[model samples]
Target chain A: MSGNMNLTLKIWRQKNNKAKGELVNYKVADISPDMSFLEMFDVLNEQLITKGDEPVAFDHDCREGICGICSMHINGRPHGPKHGITTCQLHMRSFKDGDTIVVEPWRAQAFPVIKDLAVDRSAFDRIIAAGGYVSVNTGNAQDGNTLPVPKTDADMAFAAAACIGCGACVAACKNASAMLFVSAKVNQLAHLPQGQPERMERVRAMVAQMDKEGFGSCTNTGACEAECPKEISLVNIAAMNRDYLRANLLDSEG
Target chain B: MGVFSFLLKSSIGKKIIMGLTGLFLIIFLVVHCGVNALIFMNDGGVLFNEAAEFMATNILIRTMEIVLFLGILVHIFQGLYLVFENKKARPVSYAMTNGNANSKWYSRSMGLLGTLLLIFLIIHLRHFWYVSRLTNELNANETLFDEMKEVFSLLWVVMVYLLGMISLSYHLMHGFQSAFQTLGWNHKKYTPIISAIGFCYSIIIPLIFSIMPIAFYLGWIK
Candidate 1:
């Protein structure tokens, strides 16, 4: 962590989607190995600004990685080469001195380029808006332990609820598929008693919105899980499928 | 209509559509592969031609073809939609890097490969199915075996079919495991075994189909 090291960066820079983009090269020297990847980028950008170059625009918030805002495709892997860590949490120690890194935005039609390293993720917002929330009458807060939920159900719900909405699953996906993210939301609520009233409507609305947003189908590839900073399970997808099936069947009668 | 509408709206509905339609496609592949395997049975213009013609001209088969088209459309459309949505949901995650060493190769390339298969299907149906419907005399004497052989004779065509089969296999490897899991069939006791079965089916089915064209083109069989 003490020695200075120089690293090469090949970064994708696009003024806009209509404009052609390519990987522009940069070099950094005297970098501490203890610095995170984004922190390293911070060093590089600081150098660029001092030289009158436009600094790289990357999305990040809560460097702790819980916000799911820091998106990057590092050497073709989402969230850099590490597993289960966001870009902000990825430390420079993982890379060798004088190593080269290729950086690009998440590649998918749905995630259009907003800048050099940012994209318009509002489509996800629409899908969430479709049915991501539970409907409850306004009143006093329910007691935390009032519901007699089975341990397994509680565990599964908690696990599903842990999805941080990072686009890593989509970026990691070969087809840019979103099944993991959507499924996590669906599963989180479906497993809980609080999610009952609008369970059917929730699945239906979210799925419709998912389709309307031009996302690809889940082909069951675990790339989403593999690259997920949260390691969200593919099981949520199964749960979503099951809920949708039951919802459709029951709705068919009315 | 409600059932259909429900299918469009729910996660499970999308999944049921995916599962049922996917299984349907799998069965269709089995049957189609079985019929093609007939070419290996007799070394003449008899069995394979008869089967293909029957399948092509039969009322039930035609009805099934229509349904098959519907299934493919739904599968492809829904698949693409979900992929796009997933991409947007997380604006940024991975930094540019090859993080695929930890994941199955099939999982990372299914979409691009599935798109390849779609293109293959279009050309395949056109040359084999649509062309056979033309009233030209050129289309008259072409038997299924002859048409297949003719198609495979082009080295590039055979190559494309080979690539297509590889893509299909990759798709099936992940897809089979997924379809079962979607149906809540994940028994930890049997999940790995089921995954193995799914893997075998993916590889063997496409291998069998890919071989026929290459074998026929190589004149390994009459």
Candidate 2:
């Protein structure tokens, strides 16, 4: 598995959502198995560049899987076949010689293809703008231990905060539901003491924005968690739902 | 939008309706299955008829029938909307799809299962409910159990009922706990217990329902 091998790549080629896309084929020979998946793409791009041809356009940064910019649909699953890892963390060794890999961009309407393998993930940004943060004035720093937060609650909030704003959940979902992504933000704050003041309003507004963005309803298929690079738990969704219900009840009363 | 419209408009809002309506229908199934199971007494439908009469004539239960109909309509309506939205979400088709790895087949095929169940429900209601309550085809003193016997006498009808129950079990397998999850009832200590109860309910309730038709068709009831 550690030897140089030849592989065929069937990548999607679309200038934009308006333009039709097709699977464009390329062959890369003598690839090192130790090379990262994006490195392999780099080699392909280098070849295309030397030949005076257009290089394949895709998104990547912080190849450490943290930035979440390297979003792609490899084969069928998001961020390639391996679980709990981003496309940048994917190595060539996972694939074998002569493997004809099919690569494509996220296909959700909410994440329309921007280029070949990059999608317009601005919908995620819009949802965050709706209310993904606590309202706090910045001045002299408040002590971190001022609230005396519970360790477990802090950890759970950290877990929910691990969402990188990647659109993978939308891509993997059968319904293209953004419940996992929205819930991550919702539950992250739902667990913290500081988040209590705007808890109801945050959940309600974010969900409103998510719906307005044209994402479909979640059916609790659990595919989002299975495909998420951060391994975000489905329990976050339950937390969001709980908050949402209470928020609705309160809103209706007021 | 206002609060109620807001709840009904969002993706999560639509799911809330699906969950709430699904849970409501599940309660109906439990009561229906429990009463239907009474045929096992085999006392020539005397006790079963008494129970059926109480259900049909009781003001409280009669009022609930309207509520149940509304629940079913909302459930079906929201289900269809969710299905359409999901399909539109993924307009570009995958060249090769593998669904088994991520979720159960029943979980993804809920729309198909629900559609089949809708067809079955109409036929079922027409046979017993309409005949028993709406029409004078049977005397007031006549037992509904005898109607069940006559209905299950047909092999095709029994097969339809069994198939409907299969769809129901699969639908409930996902719907039972999914409803709870959508309503945000999932928890660390309680989720496992809820899932186990849902699994058992999905299997046992459908088994009870299918058994009634099977028992009648096979002469086991006699």
Candidate 3:
């Protein structure tokens, strides 16, 4: 309380996708430096509700950075100027006493705004539905070492599997493409022995779903991986490409 | 429904369509650039013009043109669709954030650059294709070299060509790398190399294409 600081907040407010929204300003005081950015917002929201005003709406879950649900463009940067942490994991100490924080949702034509600080992320689920799953059966409850997958393949699969299905890749992409996300999923499946059974079919289905989901084509801009909280490599994207090519060529020839 | 749905519904299906169409267009550009480069090869404009004329009338080439048009349409449509759905799918966020510092500039701006490239394509086809078909059709005696020079002599034409090439380059910057990723060639060891290749191709192709018009206009070629 002795070192508590006052901060200015400019936040986006919209009723829904079709409604107009503007950044509303507010002043918050006595905030702890150890408070997370979302915690700071929580304090602000508590005050607003006590004043009988509608609380600001935002999306957050599993604040630990695993759910891929936290996304905010703070002061013009995604995830609030952090290197690899989500908004929930971001603490107040990153800012000073008098700093002005501007908060907004992911802005893109594909990501039509649903409400203030909330956009529809079901596009990702649909993309996954298009072909993100592995249908191969390798027998359950058996020894993990039975398959004898190469360590290299296992490592790559682990990395690719790290994707949390966040729309950050889409938000970060200039074309608003989800190629990185889709390719990660595809590569995760393609790298392991289990993934080999339906490798070609998997890539074919996933890429098709990504396209159907209205994501833009990849432009080789490594923005997705750079913004990825998990730091998933672009190597997965290339691997997805090789498999996709082989699948297409084989599909056509055979 | 099958064709339309296949384009809209299937990820690999969409990519295959996209890749095939893109590859075809790339082939066209390479050959077009190669033919234009002929001015540097021959002492006069004779070789390039003859080649252009033959290409314009050849039955095989004519068939390929129809395929090319279809490919362009599919590519554009699918690309647009993907952008739309990607937005719709990710409707909510868990928290507020900012820029993706790790990704490539081309990947993020592909759609915007692509829109620019589309406009450029229309203008380019109109100027080069329609004009060549109607007015310049009878200029068989004029070498492709002379015709290109005449076209490039206009400052506006040079600007348009330059802009067109730049857009194409931007498109390639993303398109090349993206196509590979969708196919699952994402090995950590090879990705950087592939991205480098994509960058180089994007820059070189446009640089070469843009130079041809400028060279023809500057009297760099006979």
Candidate 4:
């Protein structure tokens, strides 16, 4: 069906983490169903600019799901109602004419609200900074098969590397736990032979940083897995637990 | 936090304590159920009382009982604390929540079931353990089976016992495998088996417990 629609949006507006936030309503008319959700927002922003009103603030980049920057809770689910796709991928066609849609930021203690529908996700960057990387000498790229990597290990690592570091997992959890996100990072590195030297230290440092970031503990609720835009598995979490336990048991600190 | 403090204060560490205590209690259920099943012989609780006497009198078993009590206390307190910590993790509620989409309702309601089981445990210990172990005034020799008869005679008491067993069953169903998961006992081939064993054990143990009270109330064993 070829039709343009009128839609109402109730967006969360906050000046900063210290400021109080509330839902502010606005309407956009004659929007083509073909426009992406972010594109629809663009139209609304343009309208606000014409009216000399401050444009709504939100985070996005690449317009694709690759970058984890685009984060928003649409109708209570992260990255909007559709599964496996970020908010930028959601199209106006998913909604009906004259329907009201709710948009909010990822509400978690670690992710303080930055502005309207935008949160400060620097905590994730801090976690990654703690132990998300392996030490490799700076040089030309080595041969891919030099480390005798198994196909299964490579496949599993790739699956975990699919995590965009999006804060959606934290937002979807009832406890606001970042286990899924942290596990994805930990498992991805743990599965690779190149990641061996720092495996124990990596898990410990990352978990410590995660806890320091004030994120809640995971209770295996599976919400993070179900809500992850990458569709990451819960097995990553199990793997992280195994690695962490081994690290603790061995007391490895070399 | 220091290393020991980390174990006590950290989320994953608290989960490890929960897993350990839950497994300990699961084993206790086996012994409890095994001895209680002796009443099925219909010999007027002779074997049941004999076994009960050994459990009460045996020095080794007595020592283990204290450990069991400590484990239960830690499990209850830490479990509640975990529930409380998780609640604080999300200080703000979502405008609309669909938590059921990802996990089982029973798994989420573990806190409530544990609280119910705590109440049941208090009443249960007061009924038998308190008298049998705490004091010699219960019976010169007939405390084991006679106490069961007297307790089951009251329909409300029987109902509470049955309700407690029900809560225990649900709690076990989740706790059994969840404890293992938290302890990193996951395996592709073995986890499913562990889950199945937990499921069957949960049902069978509680059912045996429930049957004893019902049997006594109906005068089937007497």
Per lDDT, what order, best first? Answer: 2, 4, 1, 3
* Most DockQ-accurate candidate: 2
lDDT for B55 (candidate 2): 96
Q: Each predicted complex: what DockQ?
A: 0.28, 0.70, 0.27, 0.50
Best by lDDT: 2
Real contacts retained, model 2: 0.73
Q: What is each candidate's fraction of native interface contacts (fnat)?
A: 0.44, 0.73, 0.49, 0.47
Query: Cα deviation in Å at residue B43, candidate 2?
Result: 1.8
TM-scores for every candidate against the unseen true structure: 0.75, 0.95, 0.77, 0.91
Model 2, span A58-138: residue lDDT tens: 999899989989987888888888889999999999999899999988878788888888889999999999999888854
* Residues A1-254, model 4: lDDT tens digits: 35899989998888877888888999999999989999999999999999999899999889977898988888878887777888888999999999989888888888888788888889999999999997786367668766688898988899999999988899988778999899899989898777898999999899989988888887766778888889998788878888887787676452
What CA root-mean-square deviation does each model show from the true structure?
5.1, 2.0, 4.8, 2.6
CAPRI accuracy category, model 2: medium
For model 2 chain A, where is the 10-residue window of minimal lDDT?
Answer: A137-146
Q: Model 4, which residues run further than 4 Å from truth? A: A1-8, A25-33, A47-53, A96-100, A252-254, B1-6, B140-142
Candidate 2 residue-wise lDDT at A214 = 78
Query: What is the per-residue lDDT of model 2 for residues B5-115, given as tens digits with 9 covering 90 to 100?
Result: 756667777888898889899999889988878899988777888899899889999999999999999999889878998898778876655567677888888999999
Provide the global lDDT of candidate 2 against the true structure.
Answer: 0.88
lDDT of each: 0.80, 0.88, 0.74, 0.86
Worst 10 residues of 3 chain A by lDDT: A245-254
User: A1-254, model 1: which lDDT tens digit per residue?
Assistant: 46768899999898986777778999999888888888998998899999999999999889998999999888888888888999999998888889988989987767888889887778788878998997775467677777778899889999988898878887777657778888888888888788888888898788778767666666566778889999888878777777776776666545
Superposed model 3: Cα runs more than 4 Å off:
A1-5, A14-22, A30-32, A49-63, A67-69, A105-144, A165-167, A170-222, A237-254, B1-8, B53-62, B80-105, B134-137
Q: Which ten residues in a row have the lowest lDDT in candidate 2 chain B?
A: B93-102
